[model samples]
Target: MNTTTAATEANVTVATIRDWARRGIIAATKAAGRWVIDTASLAHRIAIGAMKRPAKPARKATFSVETMLAIGGSRWQKNGMDRVYINNWANFLPLEIDQYKTGNISWAAWEGQEIANRQALLLLGSIDKVWFDSADGELHGRFGSGESRIATRQEVWETVVAGIRTAIAAL
Candidate 1:
């Protein structure tokens, strides 16, 4: 049968039949400047549904709180913060920041309430020797002590959020 007849009988487009012929999926021959599909081969393929397209591969999830945190941690370290300090801060902050970014909570409330809590202060103090300077209210790395300047509470929170954003963009 000709390509048009095979396509009409199989309930598919002429282009689809032509593609199958080109791919050698269904046996066919050229005659009179046109493809002549073997009626038996076309019938078999239609009956068995072998013409259906293959399944696509599953895609990876691109955005998640954990992935954002990991990216933030790498960015933080790249910015010269100590590894120990970065790890400690990352553990303390994963959930709160995730919540903020996901719009579960307002940024003002998170910065003013959650970040201003005594527990937050203690977490900062814990990493003082490595990154934070409680006396000067600055976050400093081992390498850039001279360039370190005092950072306010809001600036610190902004820094964390910025790192998270930078990480997400990298992904």
Candidate 2:
């Protein structure tokens, strides 16, 4: 079969297959201006590798609720809000989050800030579109500018406290 099909069957890159063939680990032939590999030879090499090095035993992933709590607490301290891992089952969330931030802070710090943003959203009694930033770096609550708004000073404290509790429970 052609290199592309062979690579697909082998679960490796075309470059990897090329490297293996160049190393004389597998045989290949030219077909239609492209390299075609012998499926049987490729299978034998894979079987040999399986017998020699073998595949490492797969392990189950464990999610620690403590880690979630720690993340929430850390965010609360930094952002003056609450945050939770909406869905980071594989722990790749930090990398995913870095795509949105200034890329200077640690993943833990960034995660906390994100949680706090969500907390701040609810606390300020603002709609989903509103964002709040503290002027003095102390007090933070939302204030919507447009006609489509749901922010007010009177209910801000209670809503934020309730939102924090809800966010914590979501973890």
Candidate 3:
């Protein structure tokens, strides 16, 4: 199969097929100066991907303000994230929020007024998309660098709570 067909069949980009060909990850040969991937090999690759998916729903998820702040670290207390993750839970959210109405001051303004130099980790940069797996109680994502990375759940939770503390103090 040609690179275009192989990519579609494998549910990946054409560029990925080309890279696999160049790296000998799949069996391929030049035809009309283009890659002709082996269908059987592509099928094997697809099987491997299926085995790696998370058991949970795998829906798109964003970090909460506390989670993002925790990822930013000590600096978050002074300078909120340079750009809020998920457009930031705090950006337009009211300062004094309740079930009935939102306060006049926004959290984004609050952070800017309180701190500076706010750019840092809200999630692993290597991973382009992130999701939470409630069943396993873990975060799952594929790194852009073409490999899997692992971090302890404990560390994630600690930072999550720390961020909440920062927000409470800002209040």
1 against 3, candidate with superior TM-score = 3
Candidate that scores best on lDDT = 1
Q: Tens digit of lDDT per residue, candidate 1, span 1-171?
A: 766577668755455676798898899986533567998989888877745755335444344434534543332334543232344333222212213355442321122223423343333433232243333434443321221123444444555544434344534
Identify the runs in model 3 with alpha carbons over 4 angstroms from their true place.
55-171
lDDT of 2 by residue, 26-121 (tens): 998644334568889999987886789756554332223343444242222245543332121212111111222563322111112223333333
Report the alpha-carbon TM-score of model 3 versus the true structure. Answer: 0.34
Q: Which ten residues in a row are the worst by lDDT in model 1?
A: 105-114
Q: Count the backbone clashes (under 3 Å) in each candidate.
A: 0, 4, 2
Best by TM-score: 3
For each candidate, what is the lDDT? 0.47, 0.41, 0.42
TM-score per model over all chains: 0.29, 0.32, 0.34
Clashing pairs in 1: none
Global Cα RMSD, each model: 23.8, 17.5, 20.1
For model 1, the local distance difference test gives: 0.47
TM-score of candidate 1 to 2 decimals: 0.29
